[model samples]
Target: MELRIGCRRPPEESVPGLLRYRIASKIVKRQPLGGTDDEWVVIEPVYRAIELLEQLHDTPAQEALLIGRFSFNVRFKWFKNWANSEASRRLGLASIPDGPANLRMLRRTLSLEMAYRPGGVLATKIYMKHIAVATTEGCASRPGGAQAELLAEVNQHESERDLHLVLEEFRNYQEGVLPAGPGARSLTEFFAGIDAQLDAASAAAPKTQRNDRDVLNLLTKRAKVLHLGPANYCWFTGPSRALCLKLAGTPTVDRPLIGMCGSARCPQATHHSGHRSVWAEHADRTKIFLGQLGTTRKTERTRLQADHDRALRVIAGIDSAIAIEG
Candidate 1:
């Protein structure tokens, strides 16, 4: 069986949503009476109706066609299960991952058009936000809810994933594919020795937990590890010695802020080949911004020049010696 959502609504079915929905939506918007905002009454559902569709005309904005008006999340799980089923295997599609990206990916594939997209990671957040009814900064957490504990648990698993990536960099260092980072030679040696065992232990953990915490604990004595996502690595031992933290004058922070990183002078930052692209892009962006600045903006140009130079230094240091701003 096949499911197809037409790109354009049939001519006879031009208006997709009820007029009542548009009226209520306009009322909810609380516009000044008879304002321009009164036009195009908004259509919001429990889940996004237009996310996977490339609708060309006024398709009922709130009425989803796929799988009988269910949320995309529910439909996504159903597709995932189907994809992994024996039928899907016989159809030669057993290897497709059940990852989040596959949800709209399948839709786009079936619809035969590229999905409307912004930045990759940024777009994912936009999609989630679009599907949600409302988003408020203050509504981010609840003191009485289990959400905080769940978030902490999620952070632990993410940390392990991040550590494993750093370990991969160390493995490359061991193979002479890269050079050592900013740390005592003893600590660097410790990094090279145990990445494999920890990885194995992580693989052996129960499927429910992402990694074995016991395995991760083995690095506590040697590797003062903090994975700085795009910036690079920080073998952070103390905040007093932390350049980024000290520059902020916030003594409470025991880590690099990446945004305010002064890795060129810091003693704890490190870089590897994996961080080259980000530093290089930073240099490129700074150079472009500098070029576009007017002659009168000397102060801005001076700061940008420093930033560009620092980025270049970080790039050179990735395989060689500033601070991996990351």
Candidate 2:
């Protein structure tokens, strides 16, 4: 059941012929074919294989066995299921009826060693050499077909998810869940204004259908100009240049980094009626703390006062913005 990497000999108590062997020259070499003699190279594809393995499965390696070797153990059946699931996910295929058998064929095609002890519920020891050979063969054989299909499917899924989220945000604005901003009165008016902006942007862009990249670009432009602030459901508020850049391209709804939030100056931040109570409470608490500070603690009191002033300014700004719209 234990998977180990490297050429170190196992304990004598272990079953005979269980250790798969490869020549040291095959593991590493100075030069071969047209290569220069001064250049040393690792003949074994361990790092590349491990990269592929990590991408396919989330299993953590248990421990280092020896030089250039690591070990981890899994139940034989679990390993089979894991391989099958990994293949299915990567290939974007429905679960095949003969997953284990297909995997065995794949291993055979790639000339990977699958040495196991003779038992009903045996544990197989798979090595880096076997994994490397199999992964290389799989990649070489498929080249573009399965991998391309997977990439396309992934892109489609992400695009759909992002589109849904943007629509949901628009819906929230329409439902009064989000605050009204400048040049918009009721939810209906806001929606109309947004539609008009989108129309204008789309007209300015090269002709494209709704789902085309050009249209998406138009939508992104409108979204940026709208400067619709964070919804009530937002978990964090901050200066969001990174978030803005990401959304300008992909339109995801990822949470902001709380510790990095520069709320006062954040372009993505908007204070609404719903957030007034929170600001009020915070300001009140900060004021109380400021009042309790003695003259000797001048530095501490100054810092608290600065925070209080910032909070009050933010509150005033929000009220002012809302009043202009009203």
Candidate 3:
């Protein structure tokens, strides 16, 4: 920080670089002391205040040289009083927040800002799964993720770009192209109901604004509510709560860790034909791996077999849904 004085001084002090004291990055100016002719001596008090804020969060006895003779409570109280002074109030700056704990809130905000950047999802994937870093987990397992709620608000907006794609898929689904996951069965009904509701709403009100695009807005709300994944749909309107291992023992109802979803067995999970190719590949890979496994690896074999079976079941469900639609 460079503290400047309005009063005239030596010619060398004209340049800020020539100043004897330089610490943090801010601009401070000296002014009158308590409406008197005496100078307030802004440099020392403000510098110490900034230092106390910087190093005092984790410990009080930090930077003895910078924060000389300043106790933990007295420094903060002095700063707060100085901030409320008539001259300080004239600056119209927001008061400095309580350090560390309040500043940690920034980490949570940074998580949001970072997650929405150009490659935020891929970049922040590890951070989201981390126990400490805040993120909205679909596989996420955040017990009470405010981050998840923020993402929902974000997705509600950006998902608009893909609404037409969802409509196109719904309109021209394949003969056996079913949604994937256990919730697959309800997808067709939900779409149909949405259309019917729009039609009825338009008829009942006559002037009510409604279109396929507008009708599909409900999907955005549903997506937010169910924590829908981009690659999969959630037809979770029935008895099955969730089969995510993350939610197994937790008491609080939070975002389902969609990454850990029991896709085939979970009652709420559903995949559409869009996801069929991936499921097919997964099943095929597991089948090939099963062949590669020896008899001694029973556990591995059993796990692979279970995965294979789940994939097949999910594929079958998709086909069944599409066939029913036909």
Off by over 4 Å in 3: 1-180, 199-210, 217-220, 226-231, 235-240, 245-247, 323-325
Question: CA shift at 310, candidate 2, in angstroms?
Answer: 0.5
The model with the greater TM-score, 1 or 3, is 1
lDDT of 2 at 80: 48
Q: Which candidate wins on TM-score?
A: 1
Best by lDDT: 3
CA-only RMSD, every prediction: 18.4, 18.9, 15.7
Q: Of 2 and 3, which scores higher on TM-score?
A: 3
- For model 1, residues 1-326, the per-residue Cα lDDT tens digits are 11123322322324675322222111222346542222122234411343344243245344234333356777767877888889999999856564576545653442222112222222322333323312311222212223335467888887766667655655565565553345434345665567566566568874644343554466544344564746666667677777777888886875567787665566776666767888888889889999999999999999999889888877775656223221
Residue 242 error for model 2, in Å?
A: 5.3
Candidate 2 Cα misplacement greater than 4 A, ranges: 1-195, 198-256
TM-score of each: 0.47, 0.31, 0.46
List the lowest-lDDT window of 10 residues for candidate 1.
Answer: 20-29
Better of 1 and 2 by TM-score: 1
